[model samples]
Target: MRSASAADFNATRFIARLRSRGLTWVLAIAVVLLQYPLWLGEGGWLRVREGAQKIDIQLALNQRLEVRNASLLAEINDLKQGRDAIEERARNDLGMVAPDEWFVRVVPAQSVQSGKTNE
Candidate 1:
């Protein structure tokens, strides 16, 4: 018959403890693997943050476009409602003349003489 010693008993107890802790070790490894994708992996937190910034930029661009559209709409309404607005733009841009209006031409004084003459 074999004799059981204290060392053998302790070794058996240690093996049992290790077996009990195996599930904890496996769970810890699983947590680390899962966190890789949530925090550091591709299509993870970093990518989500970048996407949020792009959305913010697009929203700002949309707001600017909306303001410009509103201003253009107001200008269009003014042009349609008021003949003065059309006439003002035409006179400023085209240099138009009415039938009874006289045109004035002012020449520079330097073109009047070739010599250095004081006014």
Candidate 2:
């Protein structure tokens, strides 16, 4: 057995000291193993964060769609309940006129002269 001397650096003693702290190394390895799934594995913190962001985007899109659907429903209700709405839509979309109304088309003088010249 070699006696411990203050001036002597011992590799055997250093290795024994490391072996004495074996429990600490085991606990550190266990911590790393447990943390692996929390940070990098499936359904981990990163995956949960990404899923939350997707849900937020989908919720925003649903809100916008709901608003659009509500506006469409209101327009449908207006068209169903009011003849004025129907008449306005017909006039704007189909260019319909009342039976008593006369339709007049105005042509520019330059266009008329250009047509005559082309002919």
Deviation of model 2 at 29, angstroms: 2.3
Best by lDDT: 2
Reference-based lDDT, residue 117, model 1: 45
**Cα deviation in Å at residue 17, candidate 1?**
5.7
For all the candidates, what are their Cα RMSDs to the real structure? 7.1, 5.9
Candidate 2, 44-68: lDDT as tens digits: 9999999999999999999999999
Model 2: CA > 4 A from native: 1-12, 20-24, 102-119
- Give one clash count per candidate, in the order shown: 0, 0
Worst 10 residues of 2 by lDDT: 1-10
lDDT of 1 by residue, 1-119 (tens): 44578778889999999987997899999999999999888889999999999999999999999999999999899899999989888877887876888868666678667655433
TM-score of 1: 0.60
Native-to-model Cα distance after best TM-score fit, residue 75 in candidate 2, in Å: 1.1
TM-score of each: 0.60, 0.69
Error of 2 at 65 (Å): 0.6
Winning candidate number (TM-score): 2
